[model samples]
Target chain A: MRGLFAARPLLLWPAGCALLVASVAVAITIGPAGISVGEVAAVTVSRLGGADSGLSAIREGIVWDLRLPRTLLAAVCGAGLALCGVVMQSLLRNPLADPFVLGVSSGASTGAVLVVVLGVGGGALSLSTGAFLGAACSFALVLGLGHLSGGTTDRVVLSGVATMQLFSALTSLVVMSSADPEQTRGVLFWLLGSLSGASWPDVWPCLLVLLLALPACLGRAPALDALVFGQDAAGSLGIHVARTRLALLGVTALMTAALVSVVGAIGFVGLVLPHAARAIVGPGHRRLLPVSALAGAIFLVWADTVARTVLDPQELPVGVVTSLIGVPAFVHILYRGRRTA
Target chain B: MSLRAEDVSWSVGGRMIVAGVSLEPAPGQTVGLLGPNGSGKSTLLRLLAGVRRTSSGVVRLDGAPLEEIGRKGAARRIAVVEQEATPQVDLTVGDVVRLGRIPHRRAWAPLSSADEAAVEAALGHTGLTDQAEQSWHTLSGGERQRAHIARALAQEPRELLLDEPTNHLDVRHQLELLDLITRLPVTTVIALHDLNLASMFCDHLVVLREGRVVAAGPPERVVTPRLVSEVYGVRAVVSPDGPGGRPYVRFLPPTGEAR
Candidate 1:
């Protein structure tokens, strides 16, 4: 699947994209409401035409309000997170890089929990705003620490670890201090990344982030390719390595923050999907970015579908399924790496 | 185009690593930068290639300061192959070589036919055309070095800078690599540890000691036994050898008295 197809990357990408489209279509047919693909398609087509599908109220609400937006949100978060993963890995020049490696998710969780505990902004504190601010704040701390540590690859990762631990401790402290059990339970759900609150509003910002960030990523693929050789080599190649790293890192962080604020932090779609995509398309970011995005969308759609139906009326957080899958996938990567070495 | 460094020095934490050093080979000549470990050969090469800004003094490319020349403009004319540049990713040989064309290609444009031709030509020059499809990790050490040279050739630059390009090659590959380098129609500065190879292939040699240029001239003139003994701090005999009568170095074992 990896080597033979790499000779024809152009041919492989279209196939992967078609698989994503087909998977999203099939995934929408899932969930406890038992909507069929035909009904899903009819409602989607009628909605696109600004007309009603004339289905029964229960099925229409299931098709439109509950399942469709959640499925689309899953696809959006998956694509954005995966793209961020690709960027972080290339910028840091480490295969272990992911969206949460710099403590963005921890910071977001802290912001969300702070909102839940303190009841800030006179009850008008949207969790996303607090989460974005928290992400920005944590990123600043990580950068400051990384800079002081000379900004080496391992030093940056170490700084991220510090930031993550500090923010996680803060988040837990807030949860423990909260007087209301209901608020603490809500914070826990968000921390574990439940897509149950997915809605039409959650879909647009993610879609907007994707629309702006994906093209930016595509345009920088060549520069990112040069960076795989390291900063000195990239500088010799006429790429302003420092500037490029900062720009791409900012773009990836912004997009990842947007997704995390919406979907809480979906882990493995960003971590594992890029490696799978790199295996298929090779390390060139031009092909890896889009293929990873497509594969991520497909992976999350199916995972979320399983999350909705596996327990039957008692929904499991999608993060749990992703981690369950991600751990084994990561082990396989390590096992393969050792065998090859 | 010619490249020159005027009293270049680099320092960090208030300690100078490369002191005031200056050398300029005649344009299109093959110049060898000869020094032992910690003598600052690699540091000087980086300064000349504009990969590092000198703490003091200037690097001139065709009489213009390196910083004023701009990175893209310098890259179009200069290609650098640093020591110990092992790619962590599993890039194919072709993929790595195609990267040399980046300085010449538009940001989003596909590789043009000229770019493809240059890459193929570089592969042919470095004897890597047959291995273009092979994954980089599968290559032998000499092949990896040659692949990097092929990448430098693909840049189609007017000047090539290589830091210890022969550290991984065996005897025959080393000879072939130096032969190919001497034949290229570009200005070349190579940092080398092998005294004999430097004397044999280099048209001119610049010897550095403690971050300073101690001697500079044609290999036969500058590579004397006394100069080698003084810079390297060991006894060595130098004699003219081969058809071209280039100086050859023969080292004597260290004497207990010296120790």
Candidate 2:
């Protein structure tokens, strides 16, 4: 998608859609199972009330129940994380800002640990609910601290860093003190992020959240453009600076919380994808947001495919896979930027 | 009158930055605000531009109170260029200029024909047609200021406010920028440091000292050596040999002490 039809911006969107579809289709075919694209399409059509797919129960279950949900979740999380990253980076005017930079992921981990190891929710609350609650609390804390520190962009980032450190420490202390070795391993696996537990229930809520958040962010693209100049300049340009900042920051936080609760904090997708997308589409938020979302979707689909299948019997963490690929790609982007500059 | 500030005062942390200042610039008049460092020139301009609310008194735009107008409505009428507003993102010159059309555009709509035409006219007016596709990071300081002015011009504003717009420019670029500003039909209120340049370009001059208007009139009457000594604590000679009989100020060295 980087060089293909890039000269003609009109064809970029259609090409992006096709690339994303192709990525999902191809990614679904890569697992331990020997399901082909036709079988996968037949199982999907059969689920949608088409004719029966000529496949046994085991193969159908693997396609319908297992691989489809995981792959779709990967795409959804990828798009959502990248969207949140674009919003955060633009709103805060900080290039280093990411979805989890504001401590949402750390808070989610703490919440999951509390529910899983300490049994704080008394068996009624699921892990995702606990994580969501924790993420919200962390975001609220960051906002409060930022407000106390004069509500400037740098102050917000400083507060986010402080909140992240606090929540991370709390999560570590709780897991270390109370959990057994088995519980510790389980918490660690979720902390490092994996898509192995992706189910249909986890997929839809995230997709719904992404669907709601994408349009909402798109509507504020012009406001984000105004914000590239400082707050006074934006105010002079008719942007309600405080209101636009709050709305965008809130959308990013909610989307980040939803995705983190579902996928256990997939790293690098939020931080790196926006830069890659910006390189493709330039800094205009209208093109940058959608391009980032698509690029992220394609990227994570492939990353998750490699994560689950690289070691064959043992699954490496998706976060590990992302960093392994993200670092070299990040270096390449920096090198190119240097040459261009 | 296009823009009027009557007894406007702004204070921060119990310190008055602009105290009881009144300014009224007629339509298409270029008013220069002259002051030493921290004499509230920037604050006065901000208040007049509706970028900051006055602590006391009123600012009226076209006989309507500025606070009554909505942000978008005010922005459509007034565009401000501050001293420091460099964007962090790597944007093209065209992208920076297109930001001026935000007020005229709706949230979900694409650029209208009017917006494009205005942008093109602004780029043409600033002589930046060839540099529109250039990266903003590669632009020189003067070109950056011209781009900023072009962005403001794209708003099609009736009133323009600038704070030390030529602070970082060379002499030729400074004259070119101020020349461009004075030729615009919009009523402009600019804060400037150079007395001779201010006198040469500004139709009227308002000198500020300690947040108060020390002198206000045509540049020839206001740019005297006595006013310079009183307001800026410096000795200067004002001669009427400048362009168009505007006063030219030449500073004289102190005879006794460095203080």
Cα RMSD to the true fold for all candidates: 2.1, 1.8
Against the native chain B, each candidate's TM-score is 0.96, 0.98
lDDT of 1 by residue, A1-341 (tens): 36766677677767877887788788888765677778888898887995777799888878888888998999888888889988888888788889998889999999887776787766788888888888988888888899898977678878988999999999888888763888887777777777886889989999999999999989888888888788888888888777787788788878878888887988888888888788787887777888888888888888888888899888888999998987898788767756334
lDDT at position B151, candidate 1: 88
Model 1: docking quality category = medium
CA-based DockQ, model 1: 0.68
Residue A280 lDDT in candidate 2: 87
**Candidate 1 residues B1-259, lDDT tens each?**
4898899999978978789998787878999999889999998888988988999999998999989988877888889987878776778899899989889987778789999999999999988999998888888888888888888889998899999999878999899888998898899999999999998889899999888888989988898889888888889888898448988889999887853
Best by lDDT: 2
Pairs clashing in candidate 2?
Answer: none
Give the number of colliding residue pairs in candidate 1.
0
TM-score of chain A of each: 0.95, 0.97
Sliding window of 10 residues with minimal summed lDDT for model 1 chain A: A332-341
The C-alpha stretches of model 1 lying farther than 4 A from their native spots are: A120-122, A179-181, A330-340
Candidate 2 lDDT over A274-305, as tens digits, reads 99998888888888899999999999999999
Q: What DockQ does each candidate score versus the true complex, computed on alpha carbons?
A: 0.68, 0.76
Tell me how far the alpha carbon of residue B18 in candidate 2 is from the true structure, in angstroms, after superposition. Answer: 2.1
Put down candidate 2 lDDT per residue, B220-248, tens digits, no spaces: 99999999988888899899989988899
Top DockQ: which candidate number?
2
